[model samples]
Target: MTDLQQNYAHVYNNSVGFGRYPCLILIDFAQAYFDPDCPLYAEVDSALASALRLRKTAQTANIPIVLTKMTYDVAGVTGGRFFEKAKPLEAFLPGRATGEFAKGLVPQPTEIVVEKQYPSAFFGTSLASTLICLGCDSVLLTGLTTSGCVRASCVDAMSHGFRTIVVADACGDRHDAPHQANLFDMKAKYADVVSEAAALEHLATLVTRG
Candidate 1:
C-alpha cells in the first residue's frame, strides 16, 4: 500500500464503532448534474443508489430522515463567500431540477427537507433542534461532496452531541481524491466511517432491540 492508503487504513481502524443512533441525514444528491454545462455537476448514480438503500433502511428502522437542498434566493440574500465563488457554477438555482433531490432519492411523505445556505447543515439551521426533538442521539450521514458538506456536517453533528456515522459508500464528490481524504479525516476525529452495509446492520440492531 502507498503511504496514503496506509494512513487511511490507520484512520479506519481507529474509528469508533456505532451504537444506538436514531436519525439519518442525506446531503445534496440532487439532479443538478444532468446539465453538463454546469460546473458543480457530478455523476453520482452510485452514491445515489447507496443513499436510496440507506433511506429505505432508515425508514424501516423507524429513524427520522432529513434531506438537505442547497438553495439560492432570487435577490441573492444568502450568498456568502462560497456562494460568491459558486455563482459562476450556478447549478443549484432555486426551483430548478438541479436543485431538486436526485431521481430515486426523494424524501418520503414523513421525511423532512431542509434548505441550507451554508456548508454545514447544522450551522444556522434548525437541524440541532429537530434532531433533539426527535430524541436523536446519533446520526447516519449520507450525501454528496464528502470533502465539503459531508465533512462540515459530520463535525458539527459531533459537536452537537450526536454520535455521527458517515456512510462512506453513500457519499461522493466531484473528485475522488478529496472525497477519500475528507472521509479519512472525519473518521479519525469526528465520526464513525462505515460502509452502507455495516450501517444498515447497526441500525437494524437498534430497531430490533428498541
Candidate 2:
C-alpha cells in the first residue's frame, strides 16, 4: 500500500487510539449559519473569540487546520429534507456569502476547507482521509452549535481512532442547557471535553518541547 493508504488504514483500525500526529478541526462556523437569530444559534460569543485564538495558535504551531461549512445547492438540492424538518432559520444556499466561513475566523490559504451536508464531518466526506494524509492522529475540535455539529464531529473523530478533544468554551449552542448536556455526555462517553483555556495550556506544553 502507498504510505497514504497505510496511514488511512491505521486510522481506521485504531479508531480512538492516539497517533503521534495531531490536527485541528473547526466545525461549521459559517457566518449566516452561526447567527444568533438562527434556529440552531447558540450564544457562544466568548467561544467564537476563543476559537479564533485557537486557530491562530494552531497556525503558529504549524499544525494542520481543517474547517467545515454546511453548504447546499443554490436551488437547495441537498439538505432540502433538512430544511423541511429543521427549517433552519438560516440556510446555506450554494454560492452564497451566508454560507461562507465567518470573516473573523477565515481560513488561511494553506488551510483546508471541507464543505459538508451532514452533521458529522466524516459522513460521506473525506475528512478521515484528509486527516490521514496530513498525518493527523489527534484532532482539536472547535466550532458552533455545541450540542449539534461540534458534538457530532467529536464523536466521529473518536470513533475513527483519533484522539478527539473538544474545546468546551470554543463551541456554542443556542441555549445553555443543551450545550451543557452535550458537553457532559461527550466528556463521559465520546471525547475529552476541556475549556478553551485548558486546551490551549495543553497545546503550549506540546509547543514548548518543540
Best by TM-score: 1
lDDT of 1 by residue, 37-141 (tens): 666777667888898888887788877899998888864568577777656325676666677777777677999988888888898789999889978888889
List the candidate 1 regions with Cα displacement exceeding 4 Å: 1-13
Question: Model 2, 92-117: lDDT tens per residue?
Answer: 77665667777687678999989888
Give Cα distance to truth, residue 72, candidate 1, Å: 1.8
lDDT against the true structure, each candidate:
0.81, 0.76
TM-score of 1: 0.90
10 residues in a row with least lDDT, candidate 1: 10-19
Evaluated at residue 142, the lDDT of candidate 1 is 91
Model 1, backbone clash pairs (residues 3+ apart or across chains), number: 1
